[model samples]
Target: MMMKNVSLLLFLIFATSLSFAQTDTLKVKTDTGNVKKDRKKVEFGPGKTHYAYAYFNFMFATPPEEGTDADIFYGKSHSISYGVRYRLKLAKFFAVGAGVNYTYYAWHFKQNDNKKIPTSIIYDKEKLKINALEADVFFRFNFGKNKKSPVGNYIDIGGYGDRNFSTKRQFTNYINDGNTTGYSDYTGINTGLNYMNDINYGAEFRAGYGSMLLFAKYRLSDMFTPEFKNEISSTELPRLMIGFEIGFHK
Candidate 1:
């Protein structure tokens, strides 16, 4: 009977130990899952935070020709873009970001001089420029099975507001008779008043692989303001841009 009792006691002890061991194992797994669920951002590496970035871009616009008057012609040249952003990792795979940018827009045009007499006016050959300060807000998404890959892919979709602060035109024109009496000069014109809207709002999309990106922007607002519509009777179309963006993040 004592042997029987000893065997029973040993069995109970073994069972209790096994039960505690199983509980500990389950607890460990639960803790690990919690860690993954609560993680806010992708761990790129030590000191490689993705919350901030800077980029330089060269772009071109599809000039709007509709609002142009009978005498004004619009064409595009080169555009330079540079910006910096700050982002908040709201989830493991997503963030909301905002930043400021500067864009210099260059254009070429054949314009009829507004101030010159129509009878004497030949077309004015002009180089035009508008520069602005802009602000953007976006939601960025990160993807791919290999998050550690230095070359990766992501997407950013956002809206931007651009306020043109400067505008100028350099022109050369001869008489309508195609004679040799031509004049060339530089003039600072109010681009916002005569050609472009003072305020432009647009939608932007960027898809990136590594440090390179393809971007497209579409202006939702009219190219010219209400007051300027009468001046540029044919200039009411929206502007668009598609180009590449390259830079780095810190």
Candidate 2:
């Protein structure tokens, strides 16, 4: 009876030790696997990622080679645009992006022999302003070595479509009768021009380093409606624009 009791006690001790050893080994493996997964989650690269950014551009319109009806003062004719974009990096060197932009164009006209050009009334300072909302898509090509972040040199080739929401004509002139040496100024503003086109499309090109870029655009559509082309001057506004852009990102 004493020998059988001793043998039973030894058997229980052996089973308990075996169970504890197996539990400890499993715990160690699980902890090691969790550490490896955490390290992988924190690693960053410039592929298969998406980000959003905002940009602002200052643009200048190039002179047209057409008739005098579209002649404008080079320094005063300018455009300002701002937009936000989202980009998807498909590979280490390629990306696709889309954006929405708002652009304001001001064309200052010079005095011409024909007073009916752009507007019926002629003034010392005449400006034709247009407000537009634009949607654009582009493909980007990155250069140089890849880094942890997406800041690098890149070039973009794209196209854009615009909706002209507002069109206006503004004029200002100095008025002075034989009265005093001080002269009074006269200003007038007209809105909703029927001659203007409501839709416009263009091709865009951009080159940049980090957050700064230079851009050029060429309009592929006409600037005036069919009625204006038939009755009024058939001349079109400047189609080329050159600008510089600054981007914001994290």
Candidate 3:
């Protein structure tokens, strides 16, 4: 009877150990399955993440076909714009974004004897510029087989509104006397100008490939107010802008 009782106790111990081993193996499998499910839920792709980017543009103006009052030096007149944009992907091929930028536009006038000069001021070198804050919203459409990144070919259509905070005119001229020759520089800045429009609106389009783009903008509103339209040669500045853009993304 003692031998039988010892054998029974040994059998009970072996059974308990086998049961615990099976329970541990099942727990491990269950945990691994959960991990895989979590990974599937968090996969990175288009329409799955928010994208942030920085962009810069080099711009040129297009004067009117008939005639323009502002005859600028094409090589010296340009625009500088830098801004941050926030994009929300709505679908695999579609997204929308908005941005705010600080933009500066400079137009250097030509002082040649043959060219018609602006009647507002006379100088050897003159520059008209404006400092503005711009806000824009756009829709983006992506193309190609890659959907895992936003750094692919795309097109954007947008509209922008600008608030011109500062308008400035800078003049430089060479002065000569019998004994000496010197340069004279004068700069005038005004936050509120009677001839300039404080608010402006425009339409913009962009075609991009791998973080680089070509853009064009057309101003629907005049740069000068109607009341002061005739003050500067009865004409307006250029209404079209063509440019290239570079985008920075992670």
Per-candidate TM-score against the hidden true structure: 0.64, 0.80, 0.74
**Where is model 2 more than 4 Å wrong at Cα?**
1-48, 146-149, 177-181
lDDT of each: 0.68, 0.85, 0.78
Task: Name the regions of candidate 1 deviating beyond 4 angstroms.
Answer: 1-50, 67-76, 111-124, 145-151, 174-195
Ranked by TM-score from best down, the candidates are 2, 3, 1
* Backbone clashes in model 3, listed as residue pairs: none
The digit string of per-residue lDDT tens for model 2 on 128-169 reads 899999999999998985364465788999999999999999
Ranking by lDDT: 2, 3, 1
Find the number of clashing residue pairs for candidate 3.
0
> What would the TM-score be for candidate 3 when compared with the true structure?
0.74
lDDT of 3 by residue, 117-208 (tens): 33455677787788899999999988885354456778999999999999876667665544544544445443445677889999999998
- Give the TM-score comparing model 2 with the true structure, all chains together: 0.80
Weakest 10 consecutive residues of candidate 2 by summed lDDT: 39-48
- What's the lDDT for residue 143 in model 1? 76
